[model samples]
Each structure stands twice: as C-alpha cells, then as structure tokens.
Target: MTYKANLTQYLSNEFKRLYEEPFNTDVTVQVGEEGHSKIFQAH
Candidate 1:
C-alpha cells in the first residue's frame, strides 16, 4: 500500500475508536498531507 493508503487506514481506525462514544466525542475525519486525521473536540 502507498503511504497515503496506510495513513488513511490508520485514520479510519482512529475514527472508529473515537466514534465509539458518538454522543460525547465530536469525531471528524479530515484530509491532510499524510491522508487523514481524526479531530476530537469536546462539545
């Protein structure tokens, strides 16, 4: 897999983990140089 693919996969997993508590966590998947990142901010 390419670097971006790997990063995307990693970010996807992070989203799953963060989204576990959908009511509490504001999980956002954003595109970046690497591929993606999960941003979590308390609401």
Candidate 2:
C-alpha cells in the first residue's frame, strides 16, 4: 500500500477506537505533515 493509504487506514482505526469508548464531549484528531495539520471532530 502507498503512504497515503497507510495513513488513511491509521487515522480510520484511531477514529474507530476513540468512538468505541463512551465519551461526553467531542473528540478531535490531528492528521497531516509536521508543519501543517488538519483537525477532524467526532462525537
């Protein structure tokens, strides 16, 4: 698999793991290069 594919899979798994647990607030995940990052929110 390519780097992009691996990264996507990694982030997907992280999100799944986070969501699988009980939480009372929003969750944010950071994904991107060293100098730049994007945030993804899940509740």
Candidate 3:
C-alpha cells in the first residue's frame, strides 16, 4: 500500500481503539477572550 494509505489506516485504527476504550481523563478547552471565554470538558 502507499504511504498515505498506510497512514490513513493507522489513524483509522487508532480512532477505533480510542472510541472503543477511551482514556479515563478530563480535558478542558477555553475559547474566545481569556477571561470571558467558556470552558469545555469531557470527563
């Protein structure tokens, strides 16, 4: 297979694994103005 195809396959498998068994962690993202921004999280 081509390099691009192999890379795509690898990414696909990684996403599948992540969806099937995700990490038990929290992530926070703040968008917009620093103080006025909102925080988003996935627990």
Q: Relative to the true structure, how large is the alpha-carbon lDDT of every model?
A: 0.55, 0.53, 0.53
Among all windows of 10 consecutive residues in model 1, the one with the lowest summed lDDT is: 33-42
lDDT of 3: 0.53
Which stretches of candidate 1 lie above 4 Å from their native place?
A: 21-43
Question: 1-43 in candidate 1: lDDT tens per residue?
Answer: 9999999999999987765455343334332423224333333
Model 3: lowest-lDDT 10 consecutive positions? 34-43
Which pairs clash in the backbone of model 1? Answer: none
Taking the tens digit of each residue's C-alpha lDDT, what string does model 2 give over 1-43?
Answer: 9999999999999987775542433332333343222223233
* Most lDDT-accurate candidate: 1
| C-alpha lDDT of residue 36 in model 3 | 26
lDDT of 2 at 8: 100
Q: Candidate 3 has what TM-score?
A: 0.46
Q: Which has the higher lDDT value, candidate number 1 or candidate number 2?
A: 1
Candidate 2 has its poorest 10 consecutive residues by lDDT at 34-43
In candidate 2, which residue pairs get closer than 3 Å at backbone N, Cα or C atoms, i.e. clash?
Answer: none
Q: Which whole-number lDDT from 0 to 100 does residue 12 have in model 3?
A: 97
User: After aligning candidate 3 to the native by TM-score, how far in Å is the CA of 27 from where it should be?
Assistant: 17
